[model samples]
Target: MKISARNTLKGTVKEIKEGVVNNEITIQLAGGQEIISIITQTSSNALGLKLGKAVTAVIKASNVMVAVED
Candidate 1:
């Protein structure tokens, strides 16, 4: 898949949390980092995401904010 998103990380599906309207996907990167994404149930089913399945996490955002403990 090709898109304008530059931030793409290769990882494997670690866990899947099914919800009524959406599904939570957890991907574990090579460096042991985990990224979670929430997508529509239909989209999740269409992609066929499953445990141990290889996938890519694409990140596209207009602005990213960071906050620290006060």
Candidate 2:
């Protein structure tokens, strides 16, 4: 898979929450960090995402925002 995204983290599928139109995927990184992504149900099924499966989290964005409680 060749793409323009440079921030790719390899991890294992930790959990999957299937919804009506989308599915939430949780990936656990080597350092114990977890990243969650929500994708379309169709795409999720096509990728065959499952628990314990090795996968890569591709991160591509123009802007990333951080938040804090006031």
Q: Which candidate is the best by TM-score?
A: 1
Global lDDT of each candidate: 0.91, 0.91
**Deviating ranges (above 4 Å) for candidate 1:** 66-70
Residue 23, model 1: lDDT of 98
RMSD of 2: 2.2
Residue 58 in candidate 1 has what lDDT?
A: 87
Q: How close is candidate 2 to the true structure, as a TM-score?
A: 0.85
Shift in Å, residue 43, candidate 1 = 0.9
Per-residue alpha-carbon lDDT of model 1 for 1-70, expressed as tens digits?
Answer: 5798768899999999999999999999999999999999899899999999999998875534578999
Q: Any residue pairs clashing in model 1, and if so which?
A: none
TM-score to true structure, per model: 0.86, 0.85
User: What's the count of clashing pairs in each model shown?
Assistant: 0, 0
Model 2 per-residue lDDT tens digits across residues 16-60? 999999999999999999999999989889998899999999877
